[model samples]
Target: MEYKHVVNRIMLMIALFISIFLNLQAQSISDSSTILIQRNLRYADAPLEIGQDTSSDRLLDLYLPHTKPMQSLPILVFIHGGGFSGGDKGAKGNVALCKEIAAKGYAVVSINYYLYLKQNKIQGASAGANMKDGLPKDGKFHTGLETAVKMASADTELALQWIKNHAENYALDTNRLAISGGSAGAMTALYTTYRSKQKILPIRCVVNFWGGLASTDDIRASAPPLLTFHGEQDDLINVAYAYALHKKMKELNIQQSEIHILKNMGHAIYNYITKNEINTIDKFLTSNMPAYE
Candidate 1:
């Protein structure tokens, strides 16, 4: 009958509406997603060899697009934070970040550096008994921090150099190398971006999440348009450090810097919150970052 036909048409229209709504939601989610890449390439060892030992740290984990025939992806090298004493590439929180960023289609590399405190002596054995003498006497632990940063930075730069020398192998767009990190990893990221001297092309952008600014002079000397985030309630690496650093950069006419202080947040807020801040950071990295070669 005519009435039955009308009812069937109405049902079809409703189903179509629901399908359209679901498709839109899926698209929105994809707008904020990340991907991962898994592979290792042979790289020159000298760039990573800062000491007498000329060994290559070619190990890296990349998170990028999930499509067939991999596209040329932007590179993001992320470091972890364990006070330079202990930390691993497989750490849960950092791995989550790597996966998240990779889902967004950018290549992310989470790396492990040479840790300073092993058995306890200064540069002690990798696995051995406790050596209390290895511990710094004063509250200051600069030696361990310095060694870790140096190793991490060297590895990062070497990775970049390798990417440059073999760009076609990794399918990475060499022009868009960006560095980011949290805590001590933040120190390594910021230092590598602004403090160290490497032969590769300058890093295009830098992001610091809940990290401190060591010294302003070096940062200013090679400042590459910084984008930093910190939690206002972060007691671990006081928010003031970020604020003061921003102020100094502004004073120095470094106009392309930005800082976001999350209200009522604490250290490592990115790990606690939903991926909203992550999306913002991705936009900042991809869209708002300053122009650099």
Candidate 2:
């Protein structure tokens, strides 16, 4: 009887210890993860707009935590989706996403890059066609929509460069950077991270939302970890690309990737980042990233 009593007492102590440890961890996360926004920080001068340098279209909103932890925060550079011709860093949905991610102890930069406007606009009819069939030109002549995408990717690269240059100002860890976007923004993210003609930054991860690749051949063993969210019924970008991405990663022995296909969903899942997905992203960024760039 005395032995059983001692055993029960030991079990209770272990349970208590675990509870205390978990509570401390929760407290730590809650304490250090409030958001602080530095709005409309111009990452670049507008080279395309008439008013150019004064235009807000070239700006970025930096979302970060109130408390800078011992280690610097990893950055997530977001591009908004408007078929490369529209979308803003301060859009309602974009703002919500930036804040939600910033609250997750990350530094999020939502950038407003150059867009295809006026005579440069690629009509909607061919836009979808160009998305799947118009990339990896590898020096082939670019179509209107393709050129628009290229310009957007270049702007995204500039944003990343800007973040790297201003890393110290925001306590950011450029070595652990990730790029993310929805629709057209997702395409820019993929291209900027993978198919850029010049050497882009060594991206640690990619968050693809209903995005496709010009060619899966661009992805190789050295590609960064990718987390894709796709809608099964998405007509704009289709869900097949997500499946193909998963298959290619498997073939390359790249284990740090995932594809989440939402049922009965469509292209504009801009507001789809939920608690579960956020947890997955947090784990992917922390667990999948290697020590080096």
Candidate 3:
């Protein structure tokens, strides 16, 4: 009986030890990831260019997980909104979104593309419109705006090329790339996805925050999944553009696109991507890129 009791005690102790070890292992496995950022990495090869508030700095900030880089991290390239003439890569509000996304194990590349505006006013909407200050229409932005979009789109392509060149060094999975932007930056994202000529980087998803497309006519049935947030009271870019984009995608049978309109809000909805919305965005990415699921 004593020997049997001793054996039972030993088995009980072993079970407890195993349970503790398993708990520790589980905790370690589920440990939160830390993010590390490397800033001011030049992406453009052209002679170092500068713009208002360093807009054409041609630099990009890379955000990655602080772990053993196995060259497997998916990339989410972000552009800032400044009407193509003002914003920089280090804007604080947008940085919050970038960091939060990075913390979820994505490599976020916030880049600086050439700004297209500086005290310049491009034609608003189209000649006939309704909304604020009339129509983008209905019609697309004028030449200056169009040129800015094209230039910014080109620069964004260069940034993708840069990301591809350094993919191995940063554990970036170029095959799984997504681009996002706010306001003008959002327009650039759409341009890069549908208009950019270089096929070096294939975008899986787009998160457009208060951005207007040059024309919904540019999108096709095969375009990437879109997730957009627009403020109905947007004073800069009209909400009609967002509706037009959504309508176009619907017509094309692109079922994965979605739009969220915020009432009484103006432009700059990117700054207000709440925690819930972030989760939704993350889910959108995961769903679009099933590998992340």
Candidate 4:
């Protein structure tokens, strides 16, 4: 009897140890990966020779996955939005999204565009030195929504052209490409996706998170599939803009546009305002979209 009891206790200890070991190993495999990408993905940091200052307006950050065997991967370009007046490509907010997308087997690029460079000049409009009209329109540091959109669009087109001329070097599939953005960045993605007439990047789909859409006819013209997420309670860049664009796309018979209006969400879905939206965006990227005709 004593021998049998000892044997049972030993068996129980062995089973517990095995269970703990397996659990830890399973966690190690299920958690974040350790794949390290060691190569610099080819990308031009110069502005398009056509418009804007190449010195300040041109600069792109490319992120590539560390997948072995070097298979050709899809592409995703992200444009950050700081009201188009101030935003950096190196911000943690920008790179976090890029790295997340890259982990899912895609190459990602983040771009920085010219900010509103208006120098403070309290002249003519100062009136009697106490006349406050609105906001300072310093020539060296100023930008509006329309101007920002145009400049960002130009920069994006230039990047697309660069990729088109050198896709093979980057190990990218010319046929599979996508664009995404937050706030002004979202506007940039939509405008860039629809405005261009050339097939430089051949964007397969788009992800617009907390961004507005312009009335650019090209959105309806190309009508590439789009997935947009916006907060219903957004104060800046009203939610109506999203629905308006979707309505127009539908009218133009451009199907395959998905819009997720998160309840009680606000502007800046991926960054400061609403961080949870980033995971939702990731899920969208994971689910493949149907081929465009």
Candidate 5:
């Protein structure tokens, strides 16, 4: 009887040890899976030049994923809004957005373009007031604005070309590129991708946040797909621009284009980007430019 009792106790100990070992193994696997799913992203602030100009306006900031995937990653080139006379690549708002995009597996680059009003000063009145006055008698006013837009577009195009040339060094997928910006920056992006004569990598799509073109007449069947977000109550650039562009795209049978007119929203769409909007943008990008793998 004593021998039998001792044998039973030993069997119980063995079972307990096995159970503990299996539980520990399961926990280890769970921890590792969590770690694999969660990754850290990295960033590089401005002073990174993308053009021949050494001025701050020609600089850019970059955001990269933590882990380098086997395949090159798609990139999002962001332009900042300052009415084509201001704004920076390191602007608080732009940096935040770039980080968010990088976390989602995209390499993001925010660039600075020469401001139209910076070099050409309209004596006395501020840029805002001058813009409101419309075509000043001195003629510098209208010319400045036009030159600003043209320079901005040229700088953006040069930046795109630079990215393409250095894509391999940065682990970027040059073929799967997207351009985005807010307000004035959006205008620059639109013009650079659609109107610039200098050929570069084909833009897969565009994200226009309250951005408009001087004329949609230049839009062609070959224009890239577009996703526009505009507030119905936008006071700066009329909501008509969004509607007009949407109409043109439809007329041209551009099937992948979409415009989301947020009710009661204004020019500050960037401040109001919700999870639903992010998800929608993600879906659009994914559908248009799938991951390399």
Candidate 6:
């Protein structure tokens, strides 16, 4: 009986120690004064009367780190992918990813842009043709895609402009701005930063997840540091696109650019990126953006 009683006491003590350790860990996490997330911020309003019609897809969600070192934080603006057709700023998976990035001591914004559906009859007609025949019969297929990409790029630029206009309000360091996106959104991010006429912010880095530029020519000697993630088996947007971009980056002596290819992975690499991959991205961003360090 005495031996059993001693065993019970030891078990009780172990349980108590575990409980205390868990409480301490929880407290440590809660006490860390970092990571503030704000959702549904209207960075820009639609129908800006900029020579054409627009939609209400100009909203964005922000993730911020509260522990500001110099009262300024590096910013990452993310655009969602839907092939210029469909997608939302508040995607659950992306929001979770942005929050994780924010926890790593950076400001993150996921934005929405004008879709191809918002364009005039030309876009509608081209889209209809694309739906029937995987490719549009109208020689205007490329033109329509270009127009859609340009519109989304324009909206992305407007979002950046909005951020620049409200930098102090958001505690953002415009000098360390970066852009990221998936697929079409990734294309928009690259296009907007590389092709836009209005150079609002000095982009520090780019995170391209299975994305390609509308024009490879946009890549110049002055292009910012780039980190690309693509799947080797991506059928929708061939892995070749990423390889081509990396080749150009190398040719241009953009030593800071890198492409990570996931073996046997497909177009949905974004959905399957592991925690370790995210950590790698965090490390890349921190290494490139000194403010995060």
Model 2 C-alpha lDDT per residue in residues 153-182, reported as the tens digit of each score: 888878877887888987888777888998
Residue pairs clashing in model 4 are 117-140, 117-141, 118-140, 118-141, 118-142, 119-140, 119-141
Task: Please give, for residues 52-89, the per-residue lDDT of candidate 5 as tens digits.
Answer: 33333566677777676678988888888877656777
Model 5 alpha-carbon drift over 4 Å, by segment:
1-56, 122-142, 274-276
Off by over 4 Å in 1: 1-34, 39-58, 68-71, 118-141, 288-293
lDDT of 1 by residue, 1-293 (tens): 89999999999999999999999999877655435456444343443333532122335566667663344777787877765566656677877777777776677777655444421346532211111122223423355556656676777777777667766766777777788888777877877876788868668778888766445556664467677888888766777667866876788776767898888987776576336667866876786432344
Shift of residue 47 alpha carbon in model 5, Å:
13
Predicted candidate 6 versus true structure: per-residue lDDT over 1-293, tens digit per residue = 99999999999999999999999999888656556777677767765533342223677888887665566878889888867766676777677677778877778888877787444436343322332222223423367767887888888888888899888887788988889988787877777766776577788888988877534676789888889998887777667668877888899998988899989887745556645577888888877777533
Candidate 4 accuracy as TM-score: 0.69
| Per-candidate alpha-carbon RMSD to the true structure | 7.1, 8.5, 7.5, 7.3, 8.5, 4.8
**lDDT-better candidate, 2 vs 5:** 2
Sort order, lDDT high to low: 3, 2, 6, 5, 1, 4
lDDT of each: 0.66, 0.76, 0.79, 0.64, 0.73, 0.74
Error of 6 at 172 (Å): 1.0
Q: Which runs of model 3 end up more than 4 angstroms from their true locations?
A: 1-33, 46-53, 69-71, 119-138
Clashing pairs for predicted structure model 6, backbone only: none
On lDDT, who's better, 1 or 5? Answer: 5
What TM-score, over all chains together, does every model reach? 0.71, 0.79, 0.81, 0.69, 0.74, 0.81
Off by over 4 Å in 4: 1-57, 117-143, 216-218, 271-293
Whole-model lDDT for model 2 versus the true structure? 0.76
How many clashes in each candidate? 13, 0, 7, 7, 0, 0
User: Best by TM-score, which number?
Assistant: 6
- In candidate 2 the C-alpha lDDT for residue 31 amounts to 56
In TM-score terms, candidate 3 sits at 0.81
